[model samples]
Target: MSGFARSVVVGGSGAVGGMFAELLREAGSRTLVVDLVPPRERRDAFLCGDVTAPGPELAAALRDADLVLLAVHEEVALEAVAPVTRLLRRGALLADTLSVRTAMAAELAARAPGVQHVGLNPMFAPAAGMTGRPVAAVVTRDGPGVAALLRLVENGGGRPVRLSAEEHDRTVAATQALTHAAILSFGLALARLGVDAGTLKETAPPPHQVLLALLARVLGGSPEVYGDIQRSNPRAASARRALAEALGSFAEAAGDGPDPAEGLDGVFEELRRFMGPELTASQDHCQELFRTEHRTDHEGEKDR
Candidate 1:
């Protein structure tokens, strides 16, 4: 396909779906948003209905849609397979924006055979826009539709990374699962130590301050979304276990335990090797980030 002429977003009420709808519209597609709840805005492009429960409106939307984005929650997305597949016209592309890919990919392959499908996971919030953001694209069945979808991401300033369903889930287990676990654990530790936000701001070192800010950002988001990320990925348990083991080692090193400093040094060296050429660049980036954060904080104080 040259480009999608008409696109329908099945769960366009939610943040991710809404973002996908916006991006498709910006990419020059005539977008229609279908959701159970009334659209918050952009009424011109929205239809209120449950996708799983078929209706004429949804049927009409899917009949002419060149691209259909399943942008609902993971569980809902899975349930929508039968209904969506039934409604999707031949040659129309079906793509999903689920955070976890393995299960959805398998379901789509098994239930919607011969359908050109793609799995998408946007690594950042929609409000942040796609500019410089990473997007994981798992092409279950490659075709012109898949190419157009990838091109759409590129047009909207997203970096599209192609990965298998398994690869995508495994990577997210480390990147999303482990990272969120560590940040949430940090927040919990602060609470256990009776550290208040004001006290943290007043006394924490720069690194600690940076962590506190990250924890705050994580907590500010939907708890259900984070919970789903932790629960849905099969490898998440291993990542959590690894985090616990590392924390235990750190505690042992700090306590009256045998000297594990050599072991720690070895681990540090391994990480440095993994980072390799990126280490210096990463450090520079962090320094700049810190400077910008400090300036923003000082400006906020002046406003106060």
Candidate 2:
């Protein structure tokens, strides 16, 4: 099949859901949005209803759809799968935008064994657009519908990376869960120290400024989304524990060791070894970012 002829987004009012809905529409799919509330952009076909207690209208829509994408919370998605999949015709695709996929995969297997499904997680914010960004695709049951969805992502300039459900969860634990925890921990320390934002902005070095940028990103978004990333993934706790242990090691090295300088050097060396060849490339990339930031700041001063 070229692509899905009819697509339905269960929570098309939300960011992730809305993104998919727009993409599907642009691909010439007869897109229908079914949600508790209306989406920001009005669509020709829309159904206002809960997927958990799907009404006859909603059931008819689901049954007719070639693809049904769930963009709701983990609990809601899990709860709706049985009912939603029951309505979906065999060979129809069941997909989700959930960060954690292991549970969703299991749910689909148990609830709808014959349904062709995939678990997708957009690595970046929906507002950023899919262009040149990584979009994880966990094909639970591969079929024509799954291929169609992957093509849609690619056509929209997204990099659809194929991964298993468990693999996706493990990798994201490091990329999302651990990374967010580190940035948030830094923000928490700044707050605990009662550091004035203006003062920090004035005197903070490039690394501090970089961290502040990350802090801004985390703080600006919905806490519920970030919390789901941390809580839903089984591997997240292990990743966070690793972060805690590393911090303790650094503290012990500097404060408890006989020779602080030597201890710090050893820790740094170990880290560098762990990072391997990619560390140099990362350092160079970071330096380029710092240079760009410096140029922007200098230009602002010139304007002033």
Candidate 3:
């Protein structure tokens, strides 16, 4: 009585896609999944048909759906939207899991006015983030349908960052595209060198762990997916170039002595401006985490 009885997710087999199905099921929606590959357990039926098909199978699956999550990847997202448009019922909420929001939102607005279009970006890896993380939402309307989405995130233990389409894509370009490119570049080089990562880990300094943690994900996702994200966003290339320049400065400083944090003066200055002297709190926290660990390492060696 409290929740919607019917919901369906298309292409809900992959990580983020499967998450959509999982959340909806936990929300008490009797969900159906349409994908070539079967989704994890939320689905009532794992129908192996192209939802892009205009045939009765796609239509029938969508006809009774109160909500539909378009969870396909970006490359063929437009094509996925086209057929689903014909099948969604009047006032059905079409929550799309997508990165670029401009075209997707525009197409939905033009075709399905007031039909509850929401763009979603799950800001964590599926392996570890289901219990608690941030999920971004770009809403076309602020009503019951949007509330359903808000509830979906809350129930899934995710914080929601609501934004407009323009803001959504812009943030994704900087946060995801640019950062992913940076880590992936380093990770790919490391892979090519073919060093024993486990052996290297034993000698890796504190900063290397940070790089490993960041690159761990960038290397796991489809390389083609990363390539598309970096190329699709116009601002991504410039950002990556700027990051490259900054890294080059760090390299030069390491060999010759610009004293490590030389260029970081402005950064620290701005950060101190915001956090006052409390910015040094991280200095203590880092010392506790890394410095203490090293102290323990020395003790271990002495014991040996």
Candidate 4:
């Protein structure tokens, strides 16, 4: 039998929250969803409550939960933890789906020292589902509840990569924050150049098309979520600064000078050495993606 019989998911109306609610119900755990917005699925018991301004009804419900999972924004989770954790039983597990974990980990340690807790961050978009996707797990307090929840993630085809909260935040700063910044910078540059993206679509090379795709994906998604990713992670600023500095160096290397190509080559060689053996595999993967993108675009055109 699973340790979690009755699970509570805060912010169960959102994509990530709803995904967890569905997964828990499918796993036979009685799930109670609490959110301002009503979730689309009625499989789980729903409660309209605000965790930031939780009432007695919410506190009472938290007391009975075997596992309480927060799938809310980082700030909201931080605001809710103090009130929510106070109501939980000593053995109850508290878990969160936050992109940045260092603050949440600290909050849980301070407010819910006795309660079992973990932080889960799905690396992929919730709409994509969990299959073959990596979910970063930061285990704050180890217990049966934690194990069962991790097992639940694994059973749902999510790969759980255990990481310390600090490590998780730092790694995502480079991986998510820096990457998004670069793509956004590219989009900004295009705007500055007065280049119409639609006009370039047919003529753009694969690399440019890929950047356009990335830019579209980021711009198409919720600005609040992207903003949170950029703002919540403290180390993101450093990553952005590094990117800016690298671009500056590249610009200087490309400038009119004696042996500019030599300077560029030297920089490329250093980068190649830094990437090491992974460079070959990454290039191969990129080529595969380019082919897939090209094929997909053609198929879409044929449909029209």
TM-score of each prediction: 0.90, 0.91, 0.78, 0.91
Clashing pairs in 2: none
Provide the global lDDT of candidate 2 against the true structure: 0.88
Tens digits of per-residue lDDT, candidate 2, 16-119, equal 99999989988889999988889877963788999998989988989998999999988999999989988888789999999898898888888887888888
**lDDT digits (tens) for residues 1-304 of candidate 3:** 2156788888888887787777777677887888887765644667787766756776887888888788887656667666776777777777888777887777766776657777888877777775668888899756677787788688778888898888887788779877887788888778899888897679777667658877885667787877888887666777788778877765665555456656556555666897777767865665565645566342222211
**Model 2 regions more than 4 Å off:** 258-261, 296-304
Instruction: Report the C-alpha lDDT of model 4 over 1-304, residue by residue, as the tens digit.
Output: 3457888999898899999988998888888999997888677899999987778888788989998999987789999988888888878999999998888888877887888889999999999999999999999999988999999999999999999989999999998999999999999999999878778898887788888999999999888878888998999999999999999888778875554767688788999999999998987777677768776442232211
Name the 10 consecutive residues with the lowest summed lDDT in model 1: 295-304
Alpha-carbon shift of residue 87 in model 2 (angstroms): 2.0
Model 1's alpha-carbon lDDT is 0.85
Tell me which of candidates 1 and 2 scores higher on lDDT: 2
Model 1 C-alpha lDDT per residue in residues 1-304, reported as the tens digit of each score: 3298999998888888888887888778899998888668774388888777768978888888999898988888898888888888899999999888889877887898888999999988888888999999999999989999999888889999999999998999999999999999988988899868897799865678789899989989989979988999999999999999988877675564587556566667778999999999987776666667675442232211
TM-score for predicted model 1 compared with the true structure = 0.90
Worst 10 residues of 4 by lDDT: 295-304
Q: What does candidate 2 score on TM?
A: 0.91
Higher TM-score: candidate 1 or 3?
1
Taking the candidates one at a time, how many backbone clashes does each contain?
0, 0, 0, 0
Worst 10 residues of 2 by lDDT: 295-304
